[model samples]
Structure formats: structure tokens, C-alpha cells
Target: MPSSDKTPFSRRALLAGAAGLAATSVGVASWQQLRQPKARVLQARCDSYDANLVGILLEGMAAFPAMLAKARGGHVVLKPNLVEVHPDRPINTDPRFIAAAAAAFLEVGAARVTVAEGAGHTRDAEFLLERTGLDELLRPMGVPFVDLNLDEAVDVRPPANLTRLGKLPVARTVMSADLLVSMPKLKTHHWAGVTLSMKNLFGTVPGHVFGWPKNPLHWAGIPNSITDLWSAIRPSFAIVDGIVGMEGDGPIMGTAVPMGVLLMGEDLPALDAQATRLMKLRPEGVEYLRQALELGATVSKHRIELLGDVITPRPFDVIESFHRLRA
Candidate 1:
């Protein structure tokens, strides 16, 4: 991974240089330094999940002042991962995390907050919402519940410079949202490597256009598809739920390890970088983050400020499918 203290490169120059390097070698470290991203990251450690909801909500809110500030009176859309069907599984975003965020938005005087998601693994966004306790939590708040699955479809063309991706399925409501707050669980993915803020957007893309009914977008490729989706609809604020993270074969089928941390960011790459550190993995070692860096995402720690509790994240007991780092 590139040192956080390394000299900063302008966006244009970084892309040009990275393009040349990627064409020649694309070493994990070189690819790790994305020029700069538009997102800012803040992290906090919640010692216990048993704290009062109001207090917890405030703490969570503090990490994302920019998001709340921007969403003062407008409609805010909250997207949580509902890729799988098990709520107790703890492999996806926790209901408490989503509920706390919703409550905070209201407490801060936001006009309306809508929690939305499109389930990729099941036709049960509604079920996932209920079982996960998000539906019950948001209903009384009088905020709307949106299933992106039921939303109208919009076609997305691949960017000219990119390859591997062809087209995508996008949700009309999500695309038009005034503010997007990402609530993703911290998990290791068999395909994408690490599933963080960028990978959370997978639920926003419709299956119809991206080959869900016929072809699963997973065929488009893991990290590549991840970056493409991020480029399409980057979230304004990202709040990662790492309370009980999944390790070793996740997004599903992993053992839950308690990390008790929540990460907030506007920059997806930086968030991923921090999450990588928490997982005891090198941010530059992850393929997608490096790819995002090359594509102009922010991976520089100097560009971000860390707020709240600071501690070293322990590496996962056993490395999984990721590339081994060069020490």
C-alpha cells in the first residue's frame, strides 16, 4: 500500500500516471493511490450496542455532519444492504444501525427520510425489510418505505473508457434521490474481495437491465462491476455497519466477528481503505480499491480526517482469498 505521507498527485496527473503504470505493471501499491475522491471519512467505535438509541444516534450523526447539513430540509434516501434474506445472520447491515440513522435524520430536522433497497439474492426486499426490523423501525417515523425492485427501470450505457461492463440496471428513484446515505455491512466477499460502500450500491441496480432476470450482473465481473456502479450513483454519505462483521466467505456464509465499529464517509475509496485496515487487510492489496484509485477515487489518508476513538484493527485470524501483501 502507498504510504499516507507520500506526495499528493493532481487528479489529471494521477490518472495519466496510473494508466501508464496499470498498463505496464499495476502493482498493488501503485494502484492503491487514487488521485482523490469527493468523499470524506469519519470513524467511531461503539463499545456497546446496548446504549440508548438517542445517544447512539447522535454519535452516529456526528460522523456525518456534512451529509446531514446537506440534507437539512430535503428528502433523504437511505440505502442498506439487503442482498441476502437472513436478518439474524449479521452478514448485512444491522437494523439498529439503520434505525439509529433514520432517527438521527429526523432529530436533526430533515423533512423526510426514505429507506430504500433492491434485493439482489431474493425477490423479497419487503421481507428482508421486515425481518431485518427496518420496516417496523421506519414505519412509525412516518417516512416512506421504498423497494427499488418496484421502481421503474432506466438503462445505463458503459462509460467510453471502460471495458468489461456493457450496460446496467438502475433504479429511477435512487437516481433522482436528493441525498443518498449508504448503510453497508462490513463483510468479505468471495467475488469482489471486500464489500463496503461501493459494493452496497449493487442493490440499487435493477436486475432487469443488468441481466438479473436472465443474466446476473455478477457475470460482468466483481470489482469492475463494483466501480462501475459507484461511478454511476456514488452515495453522498456512507455509514458502514461493522458491529459484527462477517469474515471468511461472506456477504454470506462467514463467521461473525465482533468489531463494534461504524465508519462514515463521502469518499467510498477512503471508507474502503479504512475498512480494509479494520479487517487487518491492506487497502492497497484489495483489487477493487486499487481499481477505483486508478479511476480517480480518493485513497489518500492525508485527504481525510479521522474522528472519534482510534485503535489498531486486528487482522482476520486467517487470510482468505485476497492477494498476500509484500511487506
Candidate 2:
């Protein structure tokens, strides 16, 4: 991971460069040009990692296939938050959710469901997979896992110039996917505030090309990198694992908090906004979330109707110092 302080680059310089790209990327045009998306309800299930949990989760996500018309009859990609493993803290997105999502997608008519992720922090993707227990969880489902880092690369340009980044080299598998399901763990992040579906898109950029943790983007600014990458990939849908979330010092080192809930939505910003509030933080306070709303019509600001076991997230054990770091 690149240090925020001594980042081999300067934020001032990056923003200056982004200013020039902004004119071409996310044009200074009318908001009507970027037609806002409709609000959709995604059902979430609160379940632990148990045998019966997958079945219950599948039932909760039953509406997804029909909800995302594009997903049906297309190749789907399940991107779980497999950052790094920890026996004590629930840092990564639970594999149970990934398994359940894969099963649900296949049930709804997805031609093929491939489980893929580029472990940004870890050099060896296989070790990360095995330690995270995703290997065991995906095997029975016969879901194949592909290391996005080693996969072929392709250049992509987002229609929305939401960030300073220009053409990005994303994993070929991710570029060609008909549907991208951002399966991310709900956790607090020092730089991005809270990393949900949008932040999770960082893994889609092959580390082999960009460097572990994708430092080039970090040099560009974590918030800027996220918005740029998200617009480029634009995941079709999302499932956030809040069942067990990390807080305090997170995304890796943080105490586990049992929020005991799962959140789903096609509008990731709404989902991320809801997740941010669930963490007791404001959505507008987070740079990327605000940018997400800016790109759309604050679709999440209107509130996404929550379905299935709707409950307020348990107060997470967030870092006290960051509590005042709200944007």
C-alpha cells in the first residue's frame, strides 16, 4: 500500500492534471446529459456462515436476476473483497456471500459465473484465496477462480469523466464481462472513508500492470482513483457483506463488528451511502460517495427502499480520530 504522506507523488500536481482531464472526461455539461438511474430495492439477508445460510441468502436475492435484465443470458463476474486474510478480524468479504451470489446468478439464467479478484495487497493471489477460505467455498459450486492480475489486460475509457485518470488498463476478464457483481465487505477505510462496492472496484485493475495496491491510482489520489475506476468498470450490481464488518483501523486491521445484516442494490452509491450511514458516518462526508451522487441525481440521497430484515446497523467500532475527519 502507498503511504498517504510520502506518496511518491503530490495531490496538488495530480489534481492539476485531473483538471485538464475533467474537461474531456466528465464534461462540464448539464446533469440531464447524465440521466439519473431509477431507484430499485435490493433484498438483504442477515445470516452467519452456516450450511442453511446460503439457501436463505439465495431466497433473499431472488429478485436480482429479473431486476438486472442485462445479467440474464450473459457472462457474469463475481468480485468478492479478498484483500487479505485474518483469523480474528473479518477483513475480507465473506465467501458465503460470494457462493450465494454465484448460485443466485446461475439460477436466474446467467450463462456462466466466474469468480475473480485481484488481491491488491497480496502478491500471491492463490495464497490469499486459500487463506480466505474462498477456495473451499467456490470449489463445490464448481466456480472457477481467475487471478485478475495475471489475466490479459485491456484498455478502457469511462463514458463519465468522473476522475482525472485517462485510459486505464483493466483486466481483460473484467473488460469483457457482461455483468460485474461487486461483492465487497463493509469496512471503514482511512482514505476513502468507507470502502463499499465502488472502492472495491480497485481490484479490477490488474496489479501486475499497475503495481500492488494499484499505487499509480493512489498517487493520483485514492478518492480520484476510485471514481475513475468505478466509472470505467461500472459494476452491474452489488452485494455488501455487513454481516460481519471491520471497524476502527480497517479494510485489514480492525475489530470485527457484527452488524448482522446484508445489503444489496444495483445502485452502488445508494448502497454505499446506506452502508456509510450504517457505519454512523455521513455519505456526503465521503469524497467518492459524493462524487457518485454528483454523477447521478443523488439517486442514493432519495433513499433506496430496503427489503428483507431491514434493520439499523449496529454501531461499528470506528476509529475515534476519524470521527472528526468527515469531509
Candidate 3:
């Protein structure tokens, strides 16, 4: 059922809105002058969620963005992995990280920051919010949450020949944001190899149009859809929650692995590539990322410049068992 309280964002409205993106001035200008040099990625060692997450976030981003200056004032949207809520399981992006992120963005200087997700599994986006405790978690941070599942849909022209999917339905808020952050929990998946910053984008589409579990995207082919979404949305930053990450079979229903490090980068493919390296999995081993590589849009080893901590490959605790499934 589509949301009764609000109307869906139509194609005409989104076109008008996207045209207005040029007027944002600060962020749009930044993009115009944006430089991607050797695709640098920064890492910070954080043993546990109890560590000074915000401090780690700050130190690694010392050279982050000029928008950090208060006068520039821009809007930022945080897209965290909130697929399903099981308090005992390390299933979603840790709320603490989200809180730390909200604080960090404000401290640096963002005029507006919102948390948005269109959880694919369940239909009750609100109940899911309460069950996940995300509502309470974000309430104190003064960051508002938008249920993208019901938020008006907008027509988006995806990259040609990227996927069988042509124009995808995207949330208007996602399209309008100045800086969109892809915040994902590092997890191994039965089908996709592993879920990282790029896969986290599944939540940005409205469930009302796509249906529960985002079936249309799955029908379009997971690898194809992934490449298409990453190409179109093009997130400004990626922050992977690797602290107490899931190892076995996941995004959900996986065992937790205590690999405590946060991965940060401006390039989505670089982050995913670095993520694949950290997990000791070959980047070419993941079908979607390899497909991304073919498009000349994703990161290759030569394109990445690692900063902060040394790259240490974590043990693939349960990959041996699930590895054969993808084969």
C-alpha cells in the first residue's frame, strides 16, 4: 500500500527539483571543482563501539571537505543500513555510529542533516523504526528520520546499459540532498558476496512503489541493479561500520566478527574495493564490483590511496561455507 498521508514525487516534480540542484551553490560548486586523485580512502582503528567514535571520525577526516567550515552551510543525508532490527544481532549499522555521525556533521557545519531509509524487508516502516530503536537513537541527536518507503517517489534516469532497469524510482529527498552519505555495516552475503557501502543504497528507493523486499530490483538482477544504483546516486561519502561486523551469512542472520575498524572514503568503488581487500576477498570475486570496474566508474588498486591505518585483512570466519553458494 502506498502512503496515505503524502503524495509520491512525480517525474515532472523531480525534474524541476533536480534542475534546482544547480542553485544549491556551495555543494554543487564543490562537485563542479571536485577532484578525485588516486581515490584516497582513510581508515581508523576503533576496537569497539565504546571507543571515541566521533574522535576517530574527526581525525581521519582532517582533510575531509571545505564544507566543514561553518559559513558554507549545506544539507547532508545519512543513509544507514537498517535492513532489520535484532538487538542481539549485529544486523544493521550501529546506532552509536549514526549518533556520532550526526554530532560530527553538526560540529563541522551542516545546515540540515536527516536520516532516511526505506527498509526492504518489512512494510511497517514506522514500527520498524521503533523496534530498531532508531527513533530514540536519532531523537536526541536532533536529526529527523524520513521513511523513504513512503516518501514521495521521483523519476530518475539511471545510467544507460548499466542494467535491465532503465528509470528507477528514487526518493525525492535522496535526489535533493547536497551531500549523501552511504553508511553500511560490513557483512558477508549469501548471494552478493558481501554487502558494503554500495549495496546499502537499496534503502533509498521507495518500498511503496517497489514492493516489500525490493522485488523489482531483484528481478532486474542484483549485480545489474547494484551497478546502476551506484552509478546514478553517486554518494558523496562512504563510512563502513566494521566494528563488530557480521561474518557468517548476512546483511542478516550472520555471526558477528569483531573486526574493529571504520572505513571512510569519497569514492564508493574505492571503499568497496578496500572493503573487499579487508575481508581477504578478491575484488574481482564480487560480481557487481567487477562489473562496476568494467564501466570505468569504480576504483581499481591503482586508483586508491590508503590513509591513516595500515590495511589488515580480517579473517573470513564463515566465508568458506557460504563461498560455494555464489559459485
Candidate 4:
């Protein structure tokens, strides 16, 4: 685990440099151009966790050659949703799926892949990892796991400070990654409607700075914080674990709904919009997603080009407060 220097990097400078590198290496004018008019969102039917996820993921990645080219020889950091461990509830992203994602990225030429997360519900990352089976699954593969909660912190201002919080303290592991891939579980959040890739970024904020459960961001506002975080971090891509999702009063305390599908795209907002639709909920009902559109995030259904398996929309049960979110 190499450490990131204490020096802060501006969001604009970091994104500009990344965009330039991508354009030079892949012959794309910019990430914006590559995703404009319509962003390609791949949906694959992964019937079970037993399925060959790596091959399915590779096939999905093949659809976006330029994205793969950009990832070649780069260090990739996978940020998965890991709130806590529950015996019966599906509260976290499945470790097997994370392993499969790491394998897929390596197959596509990523120099290295590291799994990192700052558990909001618990500071016991070692216990959480052991209980969730991530340690056992990833250690054998030599994939290092970083507890962002304890990692060195760096203060970076978001391009758009939607939350009005001046500088956000982020973990060094996240800031130094050549590519950041958000791997969120497809679950309903009691506060945010659906907790997809954008909301999953809550784990990136160091608990050491923000306190357990990252209360400051939540108090500032979940939706605004989500938007601000995305603006600052600009994750390179998102791969949603929808094979098994939680519905009804979630992010915790929900029933599992086996969606049996995986969704992927560079446009996080759009990808989340599509996932919202898959949950048979209205994307507009998700506040941050709506804000993302108002702030120029693309990928409306009219603008999203779907690739791979065609999945029929399934209705997910939401709590009383979120009934309006149902399509």
C-alpha cells in the first residue's frame, strides 16, 4: 500500500489530466464526447452468484473498448458498499461479486486492483470483512484491502460544493487510484430512495474526519452531499451488484430481492437512473439523480443505449414514505 502525499489536487486539474490522458491514449476527444448524446449502459443477466461473473463482466467491458484502453496499465480501486454484517439481511455488496469484478478488471489489463471502503455502521473493518467473507475471498487472490476509515486523509474541494461544506476530507487510497470504480449494492435507502453508485460514495469520506456513520455529510444533506462528492471524485466507472438486492426500508433492515442482473456504465447518474427504472421506481423521485440532471449529467432513457441482456423490469417493495417512487 503506497501512501498519497499530503498535497491536495484540485478536482478540475485531476479530471482535466485524466481526460487528456484518456483522449491521447484512446483517441477520444474527451470523456464527455464519449458519453454524449447517449451513454452506453450494459445490462447483463447474471442468474446467480454461481454464474461466471468474470466472463460476463469481461463481455460487458468489451462493449466499451475505449474505457478498457484507459484502464490498461492503471491502478484500479474498487469501492464497494459495506455498511455492516448482518446474519439475515443483505446489507452489503457480496464479496464474491467484488472478487469477480477485480478479476475482470485485471483481465482487461489493469495494473492492479485494490478493494477499499470506510464502513459507516462499524469501525470494526476487520470483523466486517471476516463476517462478510471478503478477507477470505480476496486475500487468496492477493488483492489488498484498505480501510479508508483509517487511511491518511486529504482535503479536496468539490467542483460544485452542493452541500456548502468547504473542503471534504477524502481518503488517500481513493485520491491516488488511476481509476475509481464504485461497486454499490442495488438497495433502497430509507433516506435517499435508492442507494446506488453515487450514494455509495459516502464510504469514501474518512470516518476519522467525519465521524462514525459519516454524520456530517448526512446532516449537511444526503442528496447534496452525493452530488458534491461525485463532482469532487468523478469516479471513472460504476458496476452495480444487482444480482441480489434489498428492498423496503433499506441500506439496512430490508428483504432481499434477487434481481439477477449487473449494470455498468461510465455515466454514474445515468447508470443509476437505469437501475432505478429496473427497480420499477421513478428516477426523478431520487433527489440527487434529479439534481445530477439539472447539473448537466446525461443518460436519460431516451439517451441511454442499452447493451447485452434485456431484463424485464421488476417491482421492488418500498416503505410507505417511498411509495411515490414506485413506477
- Candidates' lDDT values, in order? 0.73, 0.77, 0.79, 0.90
> Which residue segments of model 1 deviate by more than 4 Å?
1-34, 37-39, 63-65, 157-166, 211-216, 317-319, 323-327
Residues 1-327, candidate 4: write the lDDT tens digits. 334445366678799999988778776434433554577799999979989999999999888777787679999999999998887988899999999999999888899999999999999999999999999999988899999999999888977788889889999999999889999999998999999999999999999999998999988899999998998898989999999999998989999999999999988998999999999999978899878876778646867888889999999889899899999
lDDT of 1 at 115: 84
lDDT of 2 by residue, 1-327 (tens): 557877755889898888878866656443433455655545455657664655665666666655457678889998888887777889888877788888878877778899999988988888887887888988988889999988888988866655456678889998888988888998998677788999998888888799887888888788777777887777778888888888878878888887777778777777787777777777777888667766663444344666676576556655675675343
Q: Per TM-score, what order, best first?
A: 4, 3, 2, 1
Q: In model 3, what is the error at residue 111, expressed in angstroms?
A: 0.4
Report the C-alpha lDDT of model 1 over 195-282, residue by residue, as the tens digit: 8888888888766555443245556566677777777677788888887788877777877888888787777788888887788777
lDDT of 2 at 205: 85
lDDT of 3 at 117: 84
Model 3 lDDT per residue over 1-327, tens place: 567436677778878888787568766544433433467788888998878888888787665664254213788888898888777889988888987887778767778889888888877878877887778978887899988999899877766546566788889998898888889998888768889998988898899899999998888888778888888888888899998788777878889888888998888888988887787777667878877776665455656888888857875644565464332
Q: State the lDDT at 166 in candidate 1.
A: 67
| Residue ranges of candidate 2 with Cα displaced over 4 Å | 1-37, 65-68, 159-163, 297-300, 325-327
lDDT of 1: 0.73
Candidate 2 achieves a global lDDT of 0.77
Give the clash total for candidate 2: 2
What is candidate 3's TM-score against the reference? 0.84
Number of clashing residue pairs, candidate 3: 1
The TM-score of candidate 4 is 0.88
Candidate 3 Cα misplacement greater than 4 A, ranges:
1-37, 66-72, 318-327
